[model samples]
Target chain A: MSAPLHDLTLAEASAAIARRRLSPVEYLDALRARFEALEPRLNTTILPLWEAARAEAQKAARRIARSGPRSPLDGLPVGLKDIIDLAGHPTTCHSRHLLGNVKAADAAVVARLRAAGAVFPAKLATHEFAIGGPAFDLPFPPARNPWNTAHHPGGSSSGSGSAVAAGILPAALGTDTGGSVRHPASHCGIVGMKATYGLVSRRGVFPLAFTLDHVGPLTRDVASNALLLGAMAGHDPQDPGSVVRRAENYRRHLRKGLKGLSIGFVRHFHETDQPATEEVAAALEAAARLMAREGAKVKPVTLPSLTDFAAVNRVILTSEAASIHGRWLREAPEGYSALTRKRLLPGLFVRAEDYVQAQRRRRELVAAVEAAFAGVDLLLTASSMDPACRIDDAEAVEATYSRQARTPFNVTGHPALTLMCGLSKAEGLPLSLQLVGRYFDEATIYRAAAAYERAAPWAALRPAL
Target chain B: MNEDEAAARAPGLGEAWRARAEEVAEAAAQARMMAQGFRAPADETAEPMPAFAVPAPARAVR
Candidate 1:
């Protein structure tokens, strides 16, 4: 039997397209059929660009046949989180207030994807304004986890996670602020990376928290994540947060393995600081052993406590969000979902002194991460406290919101990534392991994660949709 | 400040929005306290707060 088109990773499909074994049009057609069958149940896409995407695919097929692939991303179908503008498409952001908002120009990332000959087939769902969700009260429904439809897929890049995991798209762009991209990636059983802050331009992506927000990629595997990030990364003069740095081939060192490298196992972050389930803890311990077996010197290392990071992250996020939305809150108070209202309101009460103190603490946290990096090349920890819980359980969702070990990277402006490590013993969902790297060190992060993907038993498993 | 007082102090966030805004403020207050707890005193002459700066570009030979 032939391998299914939808099952091909971005790397797989791109190679096939380049070799003339697979046509871009054929690949997109297969994915479109899958999306049609599974989308209603998954609610992963808020806007489907069926005709436009088909035309683009056909165009790409012709180009590939005439010449060759444009880049590693050529002819691959990718989803854009609704918060990303796509030049004339609605950037709804899953909010009622922005239902009429349409893009005047493509977001920097979207334009880059187009230049790479990738097809944008849909606008994936996001938390309202990228901060207020899994909210049912929004204009669109929250995406369900494909592993089990009743479970949450994480958010606010909720749809990007589900779509990639469900094979509707091999890769998608997601924004991470306080773990939006990594959270969804963990729950959806995919690879997501929030590379060093300011590495990817945030000019066209909607803001959640200016300093905290990061544009990232969600892919079914580590190699594809690397390819997608490579395509979208470049400094933009328009984005003040963007940094001018030499571009990197993120996949250049994927096979370097873990030999002669120091991997820091942040056990206390999961074991004591936030306390994960037995299954999650076991999975992390096994991951450490697997890395050690792969010839990496895995050892315990400590940074600031998880509480310190979360406190600093929340204060900064809320204060910035409050400042951004204060006008809207006063003008259209009822337009927002109740949860978002609650989440953003706290920002209003943050005293100026508190915001300044958080900024100062943020500096210290950054210094701590830098210090930790002096001893270890990479840091490993639990992605979440446990497997995904029921999407409908409001209290459970609220409880788990701040229970992850991801916010510390955002606070400190380092690269962080999450990938499946094992299956949850209690809930049968994917348990994830997080890897953190020093600023602008995504190649090392990819190298280590690719090694884990090869050694870990979880990579071959897929959600039975 | 308490929620009620916070809402009242703001010009537009009045009675109907008071309770919700207050709840948000309370959450913010808790986070504030938490941030405060993580604070460690620095030296009397510690350098000024960190700020973002533009990197100086390389210059051409005269």
Candidate 2:
């Protein structure tokens, strides 16, 4: 049909490979060609695992030659965020530190993906240790937004966003501590989900904030994110934070329409707490109105002050991050970009009362999200408070890291997904909304996201880059 | 806890309270580790082993 490739979703690829209509080698070669063509413009990757990918694809072809496609993601190449360990590959979280830190063993999630027959082609770029970034002094240049290379791909999972947006990888592994994954996905016009805290294993993941870090998938669309999440969903005893959940096929409920689903709009977060740019605000309105018209109920509601939650998240995230990076901060302080080191240093000075008050406030917000869900099936907000910004604006970068719209959920540990709503006039960046689901009920979130994606096509438009 | 919950409780987590919790928490952690495959290793020097020290650099964050 289309070179057995050409922007086919993971679902389509899996079906074609199962029917023997497409070979994994052909898919990998096509993917590699597209990546090679786009890498210069996108600037989204640090390492491109060509030889390893070829070897993996040949093995997948043989396995399919013996046994028909085993999993929905069989033979698909997934880009992993560089911070996550991949055995034999250096997990250099875009920092000078850990320049040669290759894993002797695969992380629990990597092992699972290997079992699912997914090929990992490269370690995608991330903010320095998933905190300080978009600063060029680090080992790797910050990933450019695929939409406009001059624009910022919102960090800290900057590369994950750019690479997935450029079609270099359909599905990617991204960690969300403070919307590292969701912000970029929303910024880059892709599907990004931040699963509930403890829903996915973070054992081998380099620690940012031990309390807030959660790993999830960034994919081209809903179905592909589902496949990637399904492969990596279960608990591993190795990670103390991983909770035991019954293995549920994440994609099985994809077709469940949003007929009677209920969604609460955290309007105050946009309206007053920190008003979203007019374009972002308008897009959220359109997404909410569209979702409601499609069948799900949408109504305006308020949770904790977005500013209050942001403050709590700032204190706790930085405190824990400071704990994790304190040794590094003291040692290779210059090894860090100025933004991360300075931003993180405040954590060391934060009073224990602030951390505790934040956690105590967290309990309240968790109750608030729980209370909101009682009246609604999901909660919606602008994924990023605003759209992409110019990479050169240092104060804006500091303000951004200083005032992230994402930490509220990280505090409460709810599952949130970012879906592109429309284009924004502000900076001509992609505007999107965050669809947050009840704890452990990502199925409902996926169903709603897929329905919105189905009703309004975002996957059709690629970044002008 | 709310004020009511705090009032109901005997006392709250004060300075000594944190100290006491840290002690008990450390003991509980050791006990759990002993129960698991990992036995608590003997305590050793707790000096900070920083990876690299910035050479006379002033705070440069804006």
> TM-score: which candidate is best?
1
Compose the digit string of candidate 1's lDDT tens values, residues A1-465: 188989899888988888899998889989999999999999999999978999988898888888998887777898999999999988887888888898789999889889999889999988888888888888788899999999999988999999999999999999998999999999999999998877899988888888888899999999999988998888899988888977778888899998978988988898788899888999899899999999999999988888888888888888888888888876677899988887887676677776777777777787788788888888998889979999999988887776899999888878899999989766679999999987778888899999999988888899998
First chain TM-score, candidate 2? 0.97
Candidate 1 chain B — worst ten consecutive residues by lDDT sum? Answer: B53-62
For candidate 1, give the lDDT: 0.85
Candidate 2 lDDT score at position A91: 86
The lDDT of model 2 is 0.75
Provide the lDDT at A244 for model 1. Answer: 91
**TM-score, cand. 2 vs. native:** 0.86
Each candidate's fnat, listed in order, reads 0.17, 0.00
Off by over 4 Å in 1: B1-6, B15-37, B40-62
The residue pairs in collision within model 1 are: A346-B24
lDDT of 2 by residue, A370-416 (tens): 77777777888867767778788877775665334576788778888
